[model samples]
Target: MALDVGMFEGHRVNRAAAERRCATLTTRRSVKKAHQAAWLVNAVRCVDLTTLAGDDTEGRVKRLCAKARKPLASHIEAGLGLSAGELTVGAVCVYPTMVPHAVKALEGSNIPVASVATGFPAGLMPLHLRLEEIRWAVAQGAAEIDIVINRELALTRNWQGLHDEIAAMREACGDAHMKAILATGELETLNNVYSASMVAMQAGADFIKTSTGKESVNATLPVSLTMLRALRDYGMATGHRIGFKPAGGMKQAKEALAWQILMKEELGRDWLNPDLFRFGASSMLGDIERQLEHYVTGRYADSSRHALA
Candidate 1:
């Protein structure tokens, strides 16, 4: 049902006036106080992970394992270029094998490397093996590690096992930032995602990612929102700020922008930094290049091949 604008004109006029009056009431002192208050709140809410459920938490270990075998050279290169000059939405999350390509593509660029570990997409490997994988990626120049939690352990209510693995991976990352992939698509439940997010954060995950981009069901708005909310709550309880990344199936510039907006609105301005937010995209770079070309040249290119490296 569509409503007539004329019917609400009087109310709209009053609302506009009220807004103007309120705007005028925002004194410099009040504004400063508000800013300080927000800063204090942000400082208090940031935190780490807490616990987990079991290994079969979502029954997606096999699927993630398979996608890991696929080649992702082009995607990694493109993602690095997309964030080369202009302000970027986030870090490039890639497979361990693709870390070198990403490093080469983003060399000297501000965009950092985020490589997956712990048998990425699948957390079915042993804890020692996962740690070794993380160490190797870091040695290969990965600026960050996006490791998967043992969903099987989470599903079985083995919170301790999951926590220990995450802690070890975090340590393996050395000085590089660690992002924990929840693989929400496999979990298929907000409750499960929440539990996993809390666990990863408590175990020292610098960021809580939504998916690995390898599942049929990758990042979803609902799942991302839920994870963000959990991170926000966790931050409030602890004092360590955690980042959020929604990877997979994000191919359009608008989709990336939407996630950025969501993160800013839900988590506040402090979370909008690149270190705290990122888009784990595989194909959105071309779209961004096209847009930049159109803005600069007055015409869009059919392909991104001509874009500078």
Candidate 2:
């Protein structure tokens, strides 16, 4: 797929309307009691149980995999009317070096190991090195690759270059799904956000992600709405459904419900699952667990009960 420059032609986002919609999304929806707990469990299912840090270790990655396997205690899922094996995170996301650790730990459970590649967060490295990083991670058993787009291309208005780079990354992924991180915080404009989204999807990204979890600001509702609108337009134009992920700054179970409600409203209920949406977080799981505990026992579960920090 090539860049269709006209895809964004005449595209104009009404800043006020988008903001109003986001406000309504924030205020109108409320998931309570059993529904809130169910949505929290679904949030657990959609989480990418992540650990991306300067000092991530095999021990840390394996523990993350363990968390993904049984995001809640056996009794919690049983209380929620789910089988012990039914509750799990969407995937385990980690740095490429720890893919094997994640893969080994998550073996036989069918949980995909997602590795962040292509000079993640900054993406300032040379193209060959970045492409090689994707190949290396895939060869290491990464079932999915979360790639950072070169912001310079989008910033410089080099849509073709941006499309080409992402297309190459998508190719290198082979059988693995590719999540193109637009880093909305860095794109600087919702127009750029929507246009870059069109370009990423045009270039074959299986999922268009909002951030890399390393930005000063990340995954705000307005930016997400802009991206989801692009997804809606792209899907309607091509008859292909792409996934959306709101990464970073989403640390509450209530926040999870808000994103889910946005997805349902904008893209319909189909995208509420792990296949189409994911929360890229390591700490949010703890809050989601606490909320679930509150639902199950009528009291907040101490943070220490959940292994994640």
Top-TM-score candidate index: 2
Which tens-of-lDDT digit does each residue in 157-233 have in candidate 2?
89999999999999999999999999999988788999999999999999999999899999988999999999999
lDDT winner: 2
lDDT (C-alpha, whole model) for all candidates: 0.60, 0.90
lDDT of 1 by residue, 47-79 (tens): 110101133211232222221221112333244
Candidate 2 achieves a global lDDT of: 0.90
lDDT (0-100) at residue 151 of candidate 2?
A: 94
Every model's TM-score: 0.67, 0.98
Looking at candidate 1, the ten consecutive residues that score lowest on lDDT are: 44-53
Model 2 alpha-carbon drift over 4 Å, by segment: none
